[model samples]
Target: MRAVTYDSYAKDNSRLEYREVPDPKVGPGQVLIQVRAASVNPVDWKVMAGGLDGMMDAVFPVVPGWDVAGVVSRTGPDTPEFAPGDEVMAYARKDVVQGGTFAEYVAVDAPAVAHKPAALDWAQAAGLPLAGLTALRSLERLGVGPADVLLVHGAAGGVGSLAVQLGRDRGARVIGTASERNHAFVRELGAEPVSYGDGLTDRVRALAPGGVSAVADFVGGQLETTLAVLTDGGRHVSVADPTVEQHGGHWIWVRPDGAKLAELAAVVDRGALTVEVAQTFPLERTGEAFDASRTGHTRGKLVLVP
Candidate 1:
């Protein structure tokens, strides 16, 4: 099998290279996937650069990535949930960081895999898992509910884009923060767009005089903005800032949960949510994909076609 690998956590991309490697083995309660498509996220590059070393122990010669949409090649014993040739997707983060989805094949624990949404093409499915899961997890953590008014900072970003639509599906009126260039795009996702600088609170106040019922911050440095727009005792969560806890807001770290992945897929299938894949690269160009993701400018997902 040919896969991208790095022997050590480097500060640069000089270590990434594509080469032949032994295929990942299916362990108990796991299944091997023949990867069709995977997507790049900021954490992929961050992890490769050793940014998450304290959070997750890594094995050398690491294959770095997590988002995947692929077909099952085989299953390990006791895995009755799926069989050969099942089309699936996952936020396949394991306890270890060596066998990621950026390869021709990856082994995933059954608990982290879900059937791909029927409405999505391979690219969209590949991009959906991590971003969608992050958005969903943050909203759930904030206890966002129907009839609530929600504010989404960085609402045009990878996770924010989905958060806007999911908030709408929950029957909340969503106010999304974006630049002028992305206002139309954010509006298309069912959010009322507000420019993200200076008068952010005033714009949100114009839309919701009583303040919003919940706030999800996908971009960091928005603790001030979130606190200002939120009603008294309103819910709030942040994926990018741990300091949110100091302000009585929850800090979320997404985990692999197949059941929640399936629920998100159903939302996509029902036409209540959609994924935006902005650009794609071939398997050998995984590093290039990461480069684009790190720019923090793409309005949608970056995919790796394996």
Candidate 2:
């Protein structure tokens, strides 16, 4: 199998290289997937740079990626949820980062695999698992509902953009903060677009003078803005900020759940969800993709075609 991997942590993505590697083994209760596409996330590069080593352990020569949309090529013993020809998508992060989805093959636990949405192509499906799960998890933690007004920071980015659509699907009056250039893009995603930074709190207040009922901070460093705009006792959560717990808000990490991924796929098939890919790269050019991701300027996802 050809995979992009790094033998050690490096500040730059230069360590990421395309090489022929051993194929992943399918353990019992898991399935081996033939990778069609994989998407890049900040965490992928961060993990490659040893950012999470203090918390999540990583095995050296790690193949760094979690989001995959592929076809099941083989099944392990006792794996009954899927067969050899099933199309699947997964947030396949393991306790230790080793054989990841950035390769031609990955062995994933059956519980973390879901059928890809028929409405989405391999690249779009690849973009959904991690970003969709993060968005869904944030909305779930914030307890967003029909009557509430939900405010999302950094709403034009991957997770924030998904959160905007999901928030609206939940029946919340969704307001999304984005750069002026992305305002129209955010509006198209079913959120009322608001300019981010400077007077963000005041702008949201003008839109909903009574105050937003819930806030999901995808960009982090918005504690002050969130506190200012949220109604007292309203819900708030952040995936990027752990200090949120001290401010009466929840900090979230998306878990691997095939059931939740299926629900997200249902939304996609129902025409309520869609993905935008800013760029695509072949597996050999993964390092360039990482460089682009580090720019943090892309409005959509950067995907790898294996």
Q: Give the candidate number with the greatest lDDT.
A: 2
Ten contiguous residues with the weakest lDDT in model 1: 287-296
lDDT of 1 by residue, 220-281 (tens): 88999889888888989988899999999999889999999999999998999999989989
- Against the true structure, candidate 1 has what lDDT? 0.92
Which stretches of model 1 miss by more than 4 angstroms? none
Q: How does residue 228 of candidate 2 score in lDDT?
A: 90
Clash total of candidate 1: 0
> Each prediction's Cα lDDT score?
0.92, 0.92
Q: What is the TM-score of each candidate against the true structure?
A: 0.97, 0.98
